[model samples]
Target: MASLETRVTEFQENLARNSVNEIKEQIKEMQKMEESQNFVLKDCHEKTQNMLKRIVELEKTDFDDKFNHITRRMIGEVVREHLTPIQMNFNLENKSIKKLVEEHAYTIEQ
Candidate 1:
């Protein structure tokens, strides 16, 4: 039969051991949760990087298309607004010069 003091000491030791075990279990649970959160964060980071890369590619394609459209429009406007009038006046001047030269040559020959 154990003395009263020895029984009290045994109870105290058992309580300490159970508290340690409970603390260990809590620590293991926390570590598992932390690992799961890290995995989720890594996956989210990868997805965000991919989305940013796709957006850059799309923006480059859109810029190229818009540049081409503006260039074509500017070329067409230059031809219509500046080149056509210059071409018509050149043709008229060429014909007048040719007629003057023929008239002078004929008079000189006579």
Candidate 2:
């Protein structure tokens, strides 16, 4: 009877080990799920940023087309508000409102 009791105790210990292994596996699965979700969120953020960049470029082109009608002050305000996020590099080659108007007037004459 004592031997039978000892065998039962050993059996319970083995069952406990299996249960612990299952718990560990579950924990690992949860970790993987969290990692996958993080990757998805990162991808979504990248896509959103790309889309916004393209939209800004399109808006800038449209604004450029109508730049002659907008006053210099209004143009400056628009540029400051819209392009402040990514910023821009300005140099002599980058034309201002007055320069662009002069160039357009020259084109019309020629």
Winning model by lDDT: 1
The best candidate by TM-score is 1
lDDT tens digits, residue span 1-110, model 2: 56998999999999999999999999999999999999999999999999999999887786765676577779888888887654553543365766998999999999
- The lowest-lDDT stretch of 10 consecutive residues in candidate 2 is 85-94
Full-model lDDT, candidate 1 = 0.96
Q: Which ten residues in a row have the lowest lDDT in candidate 1?
A: 56-65
Residue lDDT tens for model 1, 1-110 = 99999999999999999999999999999999999999999999999999999999887787877999999999999888898889899999999999999999999999
lDDT of 1 at 93: 99
TM-score of each candidate structure, all chains considered together: 0.54, 0.47
